[model samples]
Target chain A: MAFFAAVNNWLKHFAYELQGEFLLALKTIAAVFRRPFYLPEILEQMHIIGVGSLYLVILTGIFAGQGFALAFSVELADFGAKNYLGRIMAIAIIRELGPVLTGLMVAARVAAGITAEIGSMKSSNQLDAMVAFGIDPIKKLAVPRLIALIIMLPVLTIICDFISLAGSWVIAKYIAHVTTTVYLSAVRDRLIFGNLFIGLLKPVVFSFIIAFISCYKGFTSGGGTKGVGRATTESVVISSITILVVNFFITKIVFSQLKGWL
Target chain B: MIELRHIHFSYTDKPILKDVSFVVEDNESLVIMGPSGSGKSTILRLILGLEQPQQGELIIDGDNICTMKEKNKRKLRKKIGMVFQAGALFDSLSVGENVGYYLLEHTNMTLKNVSEKVVQMLGFVGLDAEEIIDTLPDELSGGMRRRVAIGRALLSTNPMIMLYDEPTTGLDPKATENVLNLIMKLHQEKTIASIMVTHEIIDALRVANRFIVIWAGEIAFDGTLEQLRSSDDPRVKEFLRPFLSSFTEVVQKRFVEGIATENNSASL
Candidate 1:
């Protein structure tokens, strides 16, 4: 009975937070078209979320692609199918690894930053001040970040996909001793327009997940600076987990559609 | 005008304001005095519509805030401004930008016009706009930050009613005097309805035409300074005891010195 009661309470709390997040997402999406566009603020967040996370995205992309190429070469060699290295690497990286890694990196960087900044403003009564002064913090704060993430995450993920393939090409040519022409042709063969389309699409969903989770965490934080720190940690952890969970379902749908395309 | 009728507010089941009622008419200032954590700030929060009371009618400028929608409440909020305990200036903005924040956001004023208004408001607060325009909130001194916050709210909305949450607490005497003088100046020049929450007895006596003292989440006394002086309430007396003794100490010495001065003047 005690175990059941504990589980019930935890479920109830989770449901409450989830409901709150849904409403916040709806409000943020609606606010995107409302007046007071805050162009300067949106541009500022673009620089922070898109430009600031570039180094991490590049680093993750190249390393993951290189590692995958090394592992794939050994397996393909086993079957005397070394010629298929580029296609296999391309399918895996663009269809899954590239977007997931980019999403995870942005979650760690941008989401944490958003949570800490807004959390502190909330703790210190600045958000209340904005409320008191007839300014909506959601429109002023969260909407700009949302717009930035939605616009930038796709761009970031595309770059990541390109860089990852570049890494695969390098590894195929230098490490696996495959010719450049073969590597290029194989990668080109493996890509359908649908794969690239889905690769680009995943980051838009991921960006929304990261922005929504971080903003919600920030707005609800309390207990001053310690609370802000806790919110930052939670935003990063929750955004990362939610992106991965969502990635699984999204990949399933995209694969089904791609099979129809085939 | 602002009125709170039987306001009831609590935090996580701990009552902070219970059946508290007060009114401040247009062109009037009400100063609230209370011990720490006695719901003085909660009253301001209710009126600001930042926190709705569990039970009450918060009337402001002819509307009930308790029933207002969040969107409507934000519109209602433009008529009010507040200065917080720690200034609460937007840390990301420069001083001039903070002062003109809402104006820039909501109004169609050109950049030059907004800059001019920012400079004028900073001047009203006795600050040099050119000197501090580029300075961040963290870069300013405590007194300067408080002044900048006041400038921000006052110039941003041109609010009809203002609320101050212990603006003078933890300040040196000179700085405290400057803030008090500024409050009086605004009262004189703008005829703005205002509520100030402070435990500073001298400030309450000086600034308020009417005062309310809260004790244990209820109003223990509400009246003029003279009425407060003659109150038989035990809680009010206990709260005023330290200040009363110090006041008496000064008066007693002054009375003795008056006799000596009178004799010296007579001999001369």
Candidate 2:
């Protein structure tokens, strides 16, 4: 009987948390269509999430690209397949590593900040004040962040993809001794429009996941200062895990359906 | 007009309010007093539709908010505003922006018009508008933040009902007088209906027409001033006995200051 009671309590708590997240997401969607869209707020979040993460995103892309080219081109040289290094590097960065790495890096950067900001607001009763003013927190706060993430993540990935290709070119030529012209021509030849489209599309979904999860954690925060710290940590971990999981399924679905495009 | 009927609320296994029933009419001030965690603040949250009771009906202006839909509840919320314990001003916004936020978001007011209204409201709160308009909320002292919060909520052209959660809990004596005086002045002008939740008995005795003291999630005492002064209930007296000496001294000084503050209302 005690075991059954314990299970009942656990199930109830789980259901409540899940229901809260679902309600938050649904309310944000409704808030989007309501009057008084906060355009200034949306623009502010865009600058913070997109521009603030630029330096880190660029550095991560460059390092990933350089490392991939050096690691594989060395092995492929023994088989005289080093000429295909540019094509492989381009495909890997554009299709897989670029979106996943960028998503994770942003999860680290923005998700933690979102959770920390919102959680402190909760602790200080600012969220309650917003609600009392007839301003829905989901609409005024979460929707702006969600919209910013969805708009910015794809733009960042496209930039990262090109920068990563550039890094790979430099590594291939200087370290692997591949001709710059041959590397550039091979990448241009192998790349298809469909792959680029699908690669960029992945970040849109990943970013939505990051924004919602972080905002949800923040809204649910309580206890006090320690609670805010915990929310920040949990937001990053949850976003990172979800991004990786979603990336795999997206990769499988898009690549499988569009095999002929490649 | 707000009424709470046999409301039951709890967080986890800890009960907050049990069978709490009360009614507040327009142009009335209801002060809820109790020890910390006696659920004084919860009453305001219930009224604002920020939290729903586990059981019972909360009717505001004839609408049963506990049974209402979320959309309808939010619609009802436009008639009310809350002042939090720590002011709860947006840290990212300037003092003027904080005051002008609701207008800027909900109205067709131009930026220049909003700025004017903000300045006017800040002056109403006895603040120097131009000096503080562009300053961040964090830059202000505790007393200033609370005054700015009041200025933010009290100046709307529409009638507003206000819920204050410990509005003067941690203020200096002078700031407390100013805030309490501001509340009285606002009340006198019929600018807003008020329900203030505080543990400060002097504030309750001075400002409230009706008072309710909660002890252990139940209303232990509910009475007018005369009834409160004469009540024999040990629980009620225990809460009041220690403050009897200081209450009169504090009230006299503050009441004098309050009258002086009212004379300055014309400047607003």
Largest lDDT belongs to which candidate? 1
DockQ of all candidate complexes: 0.77, 0.59
lDDT of 2 at B125: 85
What class would a CAPRI assessor give candidate 2's docking?
medium
Worst 10 residues of 1 chain A by lDDT: A253-262
| Winning model by DockQ | 1
The C-alpha local distance difference test score for the whole of candidate 2 amounts to 0.87
TM-score, chain B, each candidate: 0.91, 0.90
**Which regions of candidate 2 deviate over 4 angstroms?**
A1-19, B248-268
lDDT (10s digit) by residue, model 1, range A1-262: 9999999999999999999899999999999999878899999999998899999999999999999999999888889888899999888988899899999999999999999999999887899888877778999999999999999999998889889999988888888888999998998997888888888889999989999999999999988899899989989999999999999999898788777652
Runs in model 1 lying further than 4 Å from the true structure: B247-268
- How many clashing pairs does model 1 include? 0
